[model samples]
Target: MVGARTLAHLAATAFLTVAGVVATPTTTHADESSDPDAVSAALWLATEVDDNGGIPGMVGTPDWGLTIDALIALEATGADAETAQEITAALKSHVRDYNSYDAWGVPGQRIAGATAKLLYAAVITDSDAEAFGSYDLRQETLDLVAGPELGLEEGRVKDKVDAPSVDSSNTFGQSLAVLGLSRSGGVPQSIVDFLIDQQCSVGGFRLYPYAFGGGTVTGDCDEQGADAVLDPDSTSMAVQALYAAAEHDSAGALEAADKGAAWLASIQREDGSFGGSGPTEASNTNSTGLAGQALRAAGETAAADRAAAWVLDHQLTSANAAAASAELGAIAYNGESLAAAQTDGIALFQRDQWRRATPQALLALADVSLGEIGLVDVDPGPVDPQPTPSTPGPGAGGPNGQLPATGAPVLPLAALGIGAAGAGLILLRLSRKESTS
Candidate 1:
C-alpha cells in the first residue's frame, strides 16, 4: 500500500559513518583477499556494526533485527569471523529488544514468526535454542503453533496475542519457522501441510498467508479477487523451507518447494532478476538474492547462476567505486540505484539502501543455498545469564527509550522475511561437522 517497507520507516545506511559522528570499523577494501566482491561487502558490513553489535536503521536507531541479518550474511560467506561471533555474542544481551521489535507483541503476545526467527537465529548461531534469552525460543515457537482449538488451520504457526486475533503467521514466518524447527528437532507434518496450504496453484506463495476478502483470512490465493498478489520474497522463503522440510519426509514439501522455485523462475525478467510486489515492484537485489538462493536450493543451478549474474551487475565493484570510497563492494537496490550511485555516488541518505541491499545480494554472490546450510562455531547455549532484566527488560530502552507498541508489523529492514535468512548454508556445513564430532 505505502512505499516499499520500513527499517527506520525506510532502509539503508552509508559507508563508515552517517554524518561523521557515527562510529564504524577501520577495515578498508584491502582487508580480505579472496572473493573480493563478497569480502569487501563483508568488510563494509563489519564497519557498520557498532561495538555493541547493532546496525542503525534509517533514523540511526539500533536495528537489532538487521544486525542478525548482517551476521547471517557475514557467516554465510565465512568472512569477518571475529566480528560475526562478537556481534552474535553481543546480541544475547539485546534478545528481548530484537524479539520484541521484529517478532512483535512481547510480554503477552507469542508470535510464531517472531519466536521462530529468534529460534532460527539461535539455532544458526549454535546457541541452545531451547534456552536462549528470556524465553525458550524453541518452546515459544511450538506453543504458538495454531491448533484445532483455535479454529484456524491446524499446525499453522500463528501469532498468539492476548485477545483472540487473526493468525498473522504470513508465508515468510511459517517458512522461517519450518527451517528453524527442521534443525532444532524435525518439523511436524501439519506444519509442512500448513505451509503447503499457502502456495497457490500457480506455484507462487502470497505474503499474508491467506487472501482476505471480508476482513477475515479466508479463501485461497486464487479464490481472492484483484488483491491476491504473489510475493517473490515469500515464495523464495517458502521454497527453501520446503526443500529442508522434504528431508524430514513431509509429503508435499518437495513438490511445493519445486513448484515455488519454478514459479519464481517463470516470473524472472529477461535479465534473470526478480522483484517483490508493492513498493519493490522493480527487479531488486533483495528479492533477486533471495530467489536465487531458492533456485539453487531447488537444484535449479542454471537459473540460480543467471540470477547471481544479474545481482552482480548491481554491485559496486572495485571498478565502479572510488578507491577511497567506503561504499565499494556494496550492492544497489536495483538498476536505478546503481545508476544513481554511478552518477553521483551513494548519497549519505541513500546508505540505508546499500546496507540493506548488500547482505542479501552478497549471499547470492556467494552462491550458497539455504536448504544445505548448517551451524558454524557460534557455540551453543545461552550467554552468561543476562542481568536480572529491568522493567521493560534489556533492549527495551530502544534507540532512544521506547519500544514499538505491541503488535507492530514486522515490516522494517532485516527483520522482514527478505532480510532474515542463511539457515541452509550454515546448517549444511555445521550440522555435518556436528555429526562427526
Candidate 2:
C-alpha cells in the first residue's frame, strides 16, 4: 500500500503540474502581439510590492534599488496601465531632495546611485523627471556630477561626500551615472574617461576598486587581488554606459564597449549562461540577463540569443509544470536553486533571490537592452485618471501571497496506484536533492 507521505507527494505533484501548465503560456513568439513570458513575469512582479510602495527587503521595509528594478521590468513588458500607475505612485512618495541622506530607504549620506536609477526610470516612463515629486531628477543627478564634495576629480561620481577617504561608489554606480547623464544631454568627457578607467585587464569591470578586508584601494585599470572579482553585472552596466556615450561621439567609449563585449562573449558558459566572480560566483538568471542585454547592445546577436534562451529555459514554464508548483509566471534564479527552494520551502533568502532575478530576467525575455531601457524615447500618451484612495489599497502588502509556500497536492490518492505513488515520490525527492546539492 502507498504510505501517507507517498500519497501526499503524488497529490502535490499532480496539482502543481496542472496549475503550472494552465498558468504558463505555451507560445515562444516574442512580438508585441504575443509575449507570454514577458507578460507573465510582469504580473508576478506586481504582487511583490509592500503597502508603502516599497519592495520587501532591508529589514522588511521598501528598497529603492529593488523598486527601480521592478519599474524597469514592468515598463519593458508593457504591463497593464493600472499596475504601472500604482508603481509610479508609490515611487513618487519615495523621492527626496539632494540633501537627504535617505531616499526610498536606501541609506547613504549621499544618494547618487539611487537618484541616478530614479532618473533613468523617470525618463523611460515619459514622466517629467525634472519635476518628479517636487525634486528634479535631472538637476539632482547633475548636482551629483557637479557637486564639489560628491564629484571626484576626473568626473567620478561618489556615493557620499562626507567620507572622502572611503570609495562609496562602484562600477555599477558609475555606469548608471554615465547612463543618466548621457540622457540628460551628454556625459562629460572627463566623466567618460573616469568610467573607462575602471575596466580591468581582462576587459571585465570590477564591482569595486578596493579590496574587502582592509579596504585597500587599487590603482586605476588594475585588478586589486586574486580575490578582486570581475563581475558580469558591473560589466554589463558599463557596456550600456559606454554604448550610450559612444553615441555622443565620445572617442574611446566605443572601443571600450567592444572590448567589454568580447570579454563577455569569451566568458559565457557552455550552457549559454554567464557567471560572476567574488561574492556572486554562481551562474544565475540575473547575471545572464545583464550580460545578454550588454551583448545585444554591442551587436552580439548570436551570443545574446544564446543567453536569452538560457533564461527562458530556467523560467517556470509548462514543460516543467509537473515538477514545479504554481509559480507559473515567475522565473527561477537557476535550475538548482529552484529545485532546492521547491523541496525545502521558499524561505526569505529564496524569496529575495527571485525578487532580484525575475525583473532582470524579464529584460532579456522582453528583448530590451539595458541601454535601450531608459535611453529610448517612450511616448505614453494621455494619463488615465486614477481614483484617489482614502486608505491604502491592494498595492500595499508584504511579499506574501501569489507565491506558494509549498506545492499543495491537487490530485486524488486513488488515481495514483500504491506502487506508482511510492516510486514517483522517491524519484522526485532524489532528483530535486541532487540538483540542489
Candidate 3:
C-alpha cells in the first residue's frame, strides 16, 4: 500500500542504519557500479537459501523458486571452485530428474519452471549424470518444456488455469532454457535462436512469447507493441543468459541488454531496493539480487552499490526470519515499511530469508568479482579452484576481503540487449561477422 516515494524514503533511512554511513546523493545514481565485495556478499546471502531449497524430487517442504533465482545469480557471478561445487552438490541431489514437471511433488507444476531451471544450472555447472539425468532425458525434458503440449494442473482448472495450457507464466523456465541451450554446446543453435526471438522489445523479457502479465496496469503492452513490458525477474534472467552467451557482441543483443539494465535501474527504489511489479507490494530479495547482477554486468557499479547496500541492510540476520514474514523472504525498501509490516510480522529470523536458490545472484556477483579482479580466461567449475581470495576454505580469505579490482570499467563498445535505442544499429551490422564465429 505504500507508494514509491515513501518506499524510497524508507530505504534511505534503513540503508543509513545498516550501511553504517550516509550514502552521498552521487552514490545513489543509476550509473555507479558496486564494488565487487558487496556484489559477492549479496550473492553469498542468496546462496544460503539455495542450500535449503529441497533436494529435488524430495519436495523441500519450503518452495524452491526463489532459491533457483539466487542460484542463477550465483552462476552469473562466475563463482570459483568451492562455491560452484557446493551449488553443484545441491543441484545433484535435488535436480537429478531435471525434467520432471512436479519433481518435488509440489502442488504447482509450472509455478517457476523448476524443470528447465535445474537443467540450466546442471548444464552450466556440468553436474554429473545422476544429478542431471541421462542426456536423452535432458533432450526430452527440453522438448517437454518447449513443445506445444504444455501442462496445466487439472485441480486449478478454470479457477487457476486453462486445460492443456502451457504455463508460460514460468518466466524462470524460459530464461533458463535459453541459458541451458546456449551453454549445453550440444543443443542446436535453433533452440537458442528461438529463445532469443522470444525477448520482448521493452528492455526486458517475459515468461513466454504469448504469455502476459508483468506488473503492467496499462492493460496493454508497451508503445513498441511488445507483448508485455519486461518483468524485473525475467529481465534479469534474460540479461544473465545474454551475458553468458556474450550476446552483447551480437546484433541488437547488447542494446537490448543495456535497455533491460536501464529499465531495471529505472525501477530501483531511492533506498536501492527493487520491488516486484504490481500487487506484490514488497521489495523482492530475489529481484534485488538479480537486478544487482544486471547492473554490475552493465558496469553500473554505483547502482549496484546502492542496491547491494540496501539488500544487505534489509537481510534478516536472525534465523528463519524471512521464512516467517508475511511478505515471504522479500525485503521492503526501508525501515518504516518494514516497521509497518512488523505488527503482523511472523518472526525476526524469518524476515530476510525466503524460498530460492539464487544461483543467478551468485553468478552476478562472481561476474562482477571476475570483472574487478581481472579473472578472465576462466571456465565454469568449482568456485575455490578458480583461484580467488574469497574461495571459502582454510587458506582462502572469507567470502569478502582483499579482492583485487581490475582498475577501470571495460565498456563494451556494442550496446546490450535487443532494444532499439542503444547502439542497436551498429551491433546489428557487427552481428553479421560475430555470429559466424
Candidate 4:
C-alpha cells in the first residue's frame, strides 16, 4: 500500500501540474526529510540563534523579544523539546532583562508585554508562572494593568515604564497579556474588556490607543476618522487573543473576534495575501500568515487555505529550492526576497528580516493559531482525555494542554512536485477559489 504521506505527495503533485505554477527549474531539490514546514522553519530559526541564546537584534545585540517568538514557534510546532527547554531556561535566567527596560534599575521598569509574554511561555510549558525564576510573572503581569485612576482605560495593559521603547504597550502586547493569562491563572474580564474597546467601529483594531508620538493613552479608534488606520497585523493578533478569550467564555470576546475577522476578510488581497500597516503596505508573508490564522480560528476555511497557499509560494522548499542546503525551509520576507534568495542566497544583512518573517509565516503552514497554542500538538501522540470540565492543571497539557494533533502533516511543495515550471523558481497558483463566506 502506498503510504498516506506518499499518497498526499502524489495528489499535491497532480494539483501543481494542473494549476500550472510558474517557476524557473533548478537542480537544487527540497530537503524531503523535513516533513512539516513548521518544524523545518523552527529548526532554521534554531540555526540563527547565537551563544547569548537568542536571535540577534540590530548591531548584534540579543533581541529578547525575537528570542521569545522563536521559542513560541518551536513549542507550537513541537519541533525540538530540548531546544524549547533550553530557551525557557535561558529566558528564565534573563527574566529581569526580558521584562524590564534596563537590567540594572532602581524602580525596576517592567515591560507589560514582555512580562505577559514570559508568563505565557511559562503557562504553555507548565512552568510555574506565579514563581518563574525569582519573579512571579503572573502577579507581575497583573500589576501592569491600568488602575481605576485611568478612568475609561483602567483595564488597559500598559508598559508604565518608558513609553518610547520598542515593542511597548500596543494592541500586540495587549493580546499577549490576554493569551498569557488565558488558560493558567485566567484573564480578568476588564483586561479582556480593554482589548475589546480597541476595536474600531469599522471592525479592525489599531496598533496603539494613543497617537504615534503622544503617550497619553487618548485617541479612540472611532474618532480617528480619515486618520483611522486599521492594521492587519494588530487586528490579527487581537483576534487570536479574543478567540482564546471566547474559548474561556469572556463576554463579547467572540463577537469582537468575529468582527475583526470580517475586517481582515475585507482587506485580503485578490491573490489571498495580506499587507501590514505604514511601511509594510504591500503583500507580505507576515501579515498574510497572521491574518490567515485568525481567519482559520474564525472558521473561514477557504480564506485560510488561500493564505496558506500564498505563504507556501514564498517558502524556500523543493519547489523553489535555493542553491544552499542551509536556506531550505526558511520563509522569505516577501516574493522579492524569495526570488532574490533563489539567485543570491539570503544576504547577511537580510537574514534578520528572514528570521523575523519565518516563524510568523509558518503559522499559515501550521494551520494553528497562537490563541490555540498548546491545544494541538505538532507531532502528537495518544493521550488520555480530561475527565473534568475545569481547565487543565499546570503540566496537564504539554504546552497549553497537549491534545492529539489533528489532520495529516502538510507537504510544503518546496519538496517535489508533479509538474515542471522554470529552472530556479516554483510559484504556486492553486485553483482553490475564494469561498463565499
| lDDT of candidate 3 over 343-379, digit per residue (tens) | 5563333322222212222333343421122113233
Judged by whole-model lDDT over C-alpha atoms, candidate 1 comes out at: 0.59
Per-model CA lDDT versus the true structure: 0.59, 0.56, 0.38, 0.62
Ranking by lDDT: 4, 1, 2, 3
Question: What tens-digit string does per-residue lDDT give for candidate 4 at 366-436?
Answer: 65577555555556222211111111111100111011110110122212221111111111121000000
Top TM-score prediction, candidate number? 4
Where does candidate 2 have its weakest 10-residue lDDT segment? 428-437
Give me the displacement of residue 298 in model 2, in angstroms.
1.5
lDDT of 1 by residue, 320-360 (tens): 54432446667666666676676788776767656767776
- Arrange candidates by TM-score, highest first: which order? 4, 1, 2, 3
For residue 342, model 4's alpha carbon misses the true position, in angstroms, by 1.7
Give candidate 4's error at residue 292 in angstroms: 0.8
- Measure candidate 1: CA RMSD: 15.6
**What is the Å distance of residue 148 in model 3 from its true position?**
11
Best by lDDT: 4
True-structure RMSD, every candidate: 15.6, 18.8, 17.7, 17.5
